[model samples]
Structure formats: C-alpha cells, structure tokens
Target: MALRESPESPTPRRPVSPAPVELASPAPTRHGTAALVSAAAGVLLAVLWSFEFVDSVIGDTVANNLLGHDAKATAIGGTGAGLLFAFVSGFAGTFTACNIAMVASVGPLSQAGASNRLRHHLRSLLRPVGWLALGMVAVSATYGAVGVLIGDGLPQLSTDTVGGMPVRLIQSSVVFGVIGLVLALLGLSALGLVPDVFARRPVARVVLIGALIGGFLIGRPYPLFNKLFHWAVETGNPVYGAAAFTLQSLGNIVIVTLLFVVVVLVTRGGFLRWMTDPARSALVTGTLLVALGVFTVVYWDLRVPSIFGVGWFPTMPYN
Candidate 1:
C-alpha cells in the first residue's frame, strides 16, 4: 500500500542553475596603451636623467677627454670657446654606447600611443621632455656640489707622468673594446636575440643601470680627462672643476632634448612602427648599437679608415 504523503514530504527539487562565469575586460586600446607607455617612459627618463646627471658631476672624464682643452684655457680664450667645448662634448656624449642605448630604449616606450598629427604629438611630448630636462638639471646641480667636495678632499693625482703615450694608447684601446662588447650585448638583448638573462629592459631597473653607467665613467680615467682634472685640482679651485663639468652636462642636455624631439616627430608618422615593436624595435636598436660598437673599436681603437676610405665612423680630431 502507498504510504500517505506527509505534510513535509521529501520531493525532488529543480536543479540549481550554475553561476555565470565573469569575463575579463578586453585588453586596453592602442591609444590607452600608448598613454600608459608614455607615462612609464617619462618616469624612466626622469630616473635615467637624474642618475646620469650625478654621474656627470662625479666623473667629468668624457667632457675633458672630448674637449681636449683646459677649462681655464677655454675660459681665457673666451667664454665662447668654453661654452662651445661644453656643448660639443655634451652633444657628442649622447652618441656613446650607454647614451645610445638610452635613446633606443625610449622607442618602445613612445610607440604605444595613437598616431596623432605631428604637431599634436610633439605638443604632447613637450611637457614630459621638459620635466625630464628639469630633473636632469636639478639632480646635476645637487650632485655637482657633491663632486666638488670630493674633488677638493681627494689627493690629486699627477697627470703629467701618469703613463707613457704608448701605455695610454693601449689603455684607451682596451677600454673602447670593452665598451664595444658591452654595447654589443646590450644591442643583442634589445633585439630579443639574446637569452632572457641579458634581455631585460630598462623600465624596472633604470636607476641601477644608470648608476652603473655613471660608475663606469668615473672609474675609467681617460688621458684628456685626467689632464683636465689635474689642471683643475692644481688651481685649488673646486668651482672651476664643478663649472666645467656642469657646463658639459648642460651641453648633453641640449642635444638629448633635440634628439628626443626628432625621434618623437619621426615616429609619430607611424611609418616606423617597426621601431616601436617589442621584438623589432629591439632588433633595430641592437643592430645600430652593434654597428656603433664595431665602428668605435675599428675606427677609434685601431685608428684606421673605413673600407674604401668612406669614413663610416667618426674619429676625434684631437686624438
């Protein structure tokens, strides 16, 4: 016999519906991506500028080597010569391995944005670039003062007989070779051709990288810079040393700004998107750097002309 249904009879209930899966939002648009990249680029630039500026103060080697004139002599020759030397050295330094790497690294950062009209794109870059410049100047001044203190406190080394000409030439060649190797590795990494260990970009550790570059400049004393430093130290005027280096740094700033502006303008046209591509940009940058390194070694180190006398690389007239 069927049992009578109880008031609270157990009954099969309808199946419970499964919870809906939530979807992630779509990836950021190119414009949004560009904006984010630009912001990051600005921060990177600020950090690099700050560190390099300090390094400039600490070393001043590149300035002295490239200028090939005593700061005092220039000052006596006329403020014009001093200023010109400062500007020339600063501008020329931008082409060095570390500096060129800095420039190439920015390409990926700038590529994220939408292609605006050339005028508008440049306008957008101006503010960030201006901030970068200001950061450099501010940091340079602070560090320049510190450099002066260090210069005054340290026992001066005699430049007159530091080494024979042959020894110095060999030393310079070895230094350039090492720098060329470093640049070559950097270029390969930028191209993504190297192992992941070496391919790390500049975004996260830019400060550290900049510091390393600065340290390198400081530790390696070239003949010209050594001579200049000796002259400044003998005078017993830290101001002269500080001013000379500071002016040189300012010269670098001017060229760097101009170059950056040109990059922004050229890239804005979108004709060079390959330059901004994560992989491709690396390739191009790496190629250029490798070429630069090779050229430095062959031309500057060997003191040889390019094939067919083409003058593919620049050689310092003073050298």
Candidate 2:
C-alpha cells in the first residue's frame, strides 16, 4: 500500500456535461392593430363629413342671403369658407353628450379578447363593427332621401297655411318638438328613470334607439343640410342633398368608431367590466342624453329665428 504513489498516476476526474442552452422566449404576438387601423379610418371619415356639413351650412346661408338664392353661389361659398367652419364644428361635436354616450355604449363591444395575437382580436371585432357601420350607412342614406323629398315639396307648400300657420313653420316646430321629447325620453330610459320596456330586448332596442338618435343628429332642421336640400330641390339636383346627409352620417360613424377605439384603449377591458353593470350604464347614458335633449330644444326652439332663418324654419325672403 505504501508503494502505490507514482508520478505518472492521473487524478480521477468526473465527466462534465455541457451547460443547458436557454432558447429565447417565444416572441409575443401583437394585437389590436386592425382595430387601430379601423379607428384611424373612422377619424378621417368623420373629419371629411364634418367639413362637408359645415360647408353646406355656410354655403347655403351665403347663397340664400348674400347671393340671392343662387345655387352657384352656394357651391362656391360652401366649398370655400365652409371647410374652416366644418373643422370647428366637427371638433366641437367630439365633446358633445350624445357623442360621448355613443362611445360609451359601443366602445366595450369593440374590444377583442385577452389574446396576444392582433389578428385574432381583429377577426373577432370586425363583424360587429362592420355591421354597425353598415347599419349607420343605411339609416343615413334613408335620412338623405327623406331630406330630398322634404326639400322638393317645401317650395310648393311654403305658401300653404295650416291653422293660420305657414305649413313650413308648423312642420318645423312639430318635428323639432317631437324629436326633443323623444330624446328626453330616451335619456330618461338610459338613466333607469323610465320603465323597463326597452330593457327586455337590449340588442334590437339599442340599435333602433341609435338609428333614431342618429337621424335627429344628422338631419335636424335649421342646419345647413336642410337648407342645402331645399336648394338642391329647387335646382333639380337631388344628388347634392342625398350626398350631404349621407356624408354627414358617414362622419358620425367615423366619430363613434374612433371613440370606441379610444375608450377600449384607455380602459383596457375595465370599461367592458364596468359596462356589465346595466344600472351604471343607464345612469351615465341617461345624463348625457338629457343634456343633449335640452340643448336640441333650446337651439331649435329658442335660438333659431322664426322669420328670417332659412331651411325648415319659416322665414320671410330676404329682400
């Protein structure tokens, strides 16, 4: 045993294995790109629509007042100064109660699930958003057609009297009053102050409510579109009238869509969670609607001049 120590003896060594290689974590999937794109498109359309609406308002006013009811004047003036006004109005509309309510209602639905993939989320959202857009377009176009008809018939009926009131004046007042009432009721319902009749069928009721509200928002009398429709009818150019309202509707669609996108982004699913509380939704929506309704009434009934204003409101021709 003592003789085993030798210079050539190698020390025993344990086998060393290579260190385990760590593969990079799988790349995270991007989500919500499509929704973002859609929102951008909606913003663009809204701007365009708002611009056109402003143009119609200013152009009609100038043409009817300054240029002696000339269609040529309207086209020129509206296309010129209208662009500036439209931008202002469009920007202003973003902060309105009706618009805010619409955003609150639709924003939650625009969200895709918690999936990390962008495409998957987009696929989920596309159908609902597309259907909403399509519905808006259909309703808007119908409003346009109605405007055209109203414009065409106004001139013939302007001189006609109903119960000692000008047919036009009567028509304007009644329409305005009725719409204001409807808006107020809608607001009340949203606040949960009204009965639960509309709550029974939430989906259909919401869509129908949106359509009615949208119709009033886009095609209200005393606005430029109404005047433009009249001018178009006088000139036998119904296309102009139709285009104006349709474009405005498109603008509304864009605004709503963009709002939905913003809310979804900001809340990050919290809005969806919150929206599940119907009572809360109703309260918020009702408050906004009430404000809008009151504003509508004041603007149309109180501010609008009874005799000198153009459009559906009865007015003496400016000499």
Candidate 3:
C-alpha cells in the first residue's frame, strides 16, 4: 500500500500573473523651464530690435507720436500747467525706451491675494499698487529734490560728449547696466534658478522694483524730462521739482493700474486666481523680469556702444 502512492503525483504550480505594466503618461511640461526659455526668447526679440531701424520704426514713430514731439515744456508752463505737463508727459511717454520696461512691474503685483467678495477683491487688487508707490515715492521725490538742487551738475545730465559719445549716454550705460543685471537676477530668482529671496520677501521685492522704476528718471535722456528738468532748475524750488517728479512717477504707474483694472474686468476677476497657481506665477514673473532685464542691458550696453564705434553688433539693412 505504501509503494502504490509513488506513481503520478507531479508538483502543481500556481499560475503567475505578469506584473501590471505601468503606462506612464508623458511628463508634464515643466513650467520653470518653460518660463526660463520664454525669458530668453524675449531677450532675442529685444536683440533683434537693437538695429537703428528699430529706432526709426518703433522709437521714432510710436514713441514720438505718444510723447508728442515739438510740444515744448515751456509751453506747458504755468504753476498748474507745469505739474499737469509733467504727469501728462510721463503718461504719454510710457512706451519710451527707458520706461517701457516698467510694464514688467505688473508681474510683482500678481502676487496679490484674491477675494471673492467684490469690495474686498478690489481692495486686494489695489493694495500691492499702493505698496509699490511707497517705494516709488521715496526714490522719485528724493531724486527730484536732489536733481534740482544739483541742476545739471550730475554727469548724467551733462551735455558734453566724449569720443563722439554723449557723456550723459555713458552715464546711461553704467546705470542701466547695473539695473539690468539686478532685474536678470530677479528673474532667475523667480524661476528658482537663484535663491528664492522673493518668495518670503514679496514686499521687499516689490519695493525694490518700485525703487528701480522711480530711479529711471536718474538716467533718463528723454527730451521732455530734460526740458522739465531745466524748467525745475529755473524755478529754484526743490519742492516744486520734487512735486513734479513725484507726479510724474505717479502718472507712470497710473497706466499700470488702469491696465490691471482692465485685465481684472476682462477676466472677470479670474486673473488674480490664475496667479495663485505657483507654476503660473513663477512663469509670468520670471519671463517678464528676464526679458526686460536683458533688454535693458543689451540695449544700453551693447547696442548703444555699437552706435559710437566702441564695439560691433549686427545691424539690419534699414538701420
């Protein structure tokens, strides 16, 4: 009986199911990398426009039309008229080379928190703008007081030329170069390529940006600002100069405010919510900072130097 059990009892094995194959969806497009690339594209656009023809086309035509060429500052000269002129001129010249970059400021305001309640929502929208003005007023007003007190003594306001290059332009090169570098770094910070100083320090970053925009006057070569400056000096009232410059900076930011209003209205208050998304916020902020930063540097440092034979950059046929 024991010997009978040996015949056909082969070992039975359980069927092994193949491990589930994971079909990984393609990786999502990285917002950070995309943002960085966008910044580079913006710089390329600016570089392409570095030719003299861009001056003829965009600068002369669009900027001149907006800035109202031949409208003398002296013509706009009463006490009220002068201040009015300063503001209006600033508003008109928003598209000018020195100031257009300021549009990038909207990027920082994107950090503002959103509210569903209408009254609170509007306040939230405007709060950042006010913070920006705090820093702007400090710089613009202080510079105005100092600028008028000095009255053409600053090398930036000088009318002389060296090696066929305007001395004021040289000053422009230096000032803009530094600011441009700062802006580029800010962009990197936004993209998290650099230390994310701005993440925990929103107010400070905004204030810094506001200060930079306010400082634009320090390097301005605009004919209107020059005229206003001379008129300010003629009056010999630093208070008047400070008031005028402060109004000017206010006018510049007014356009930004209006654009914000339009955007919020158009999006039905959705843009603010859109900005809450970390990836989108980083994309927007990083792109703008890098673009304008690089433009400021390349235009003032490279393009301008090339104009006076200091170095060479590519020029278009129309240029």
- List lDDT for all candidates, in order: 0.44, 0.46, 0.75
Candidate 1 residues 14-48, lDDT tens each?
99999999875432243234333433443333223
- The list of candidate 3 runs beyond 4 A from truth reads 1-32, 50-69, 73-76, 113-119
Q: In model 3, how large is the Cα lDDT of residue 309?
A: 94
Q: Which candidate is the best by lDDT?
A: 3
Ranking by lDDT: 3, 2, 1
Worst 10 residues of 1 by lDDT: 204-213
User: Candidate 3: lDDT over CA atoms?
Assistant: 0.75
Question: Could you tell me how far off, in angstroms, the CA of residue 220 lies in candidate 1 after the best superposition?
Answer: 8.5
RMSD of 2: 18.4
Those runs of model 1 whose alpha carbons end farther than 4 Å from true positions after fitting are 1-85, 92-171, 197-200, 204-231, 234-243, 266-274, 297-319
TM-score of 2: 0.52
- Cα lDDT of model 1 overall? 0.44
Candidate order by decreasing TM-score: 3, 2, 1
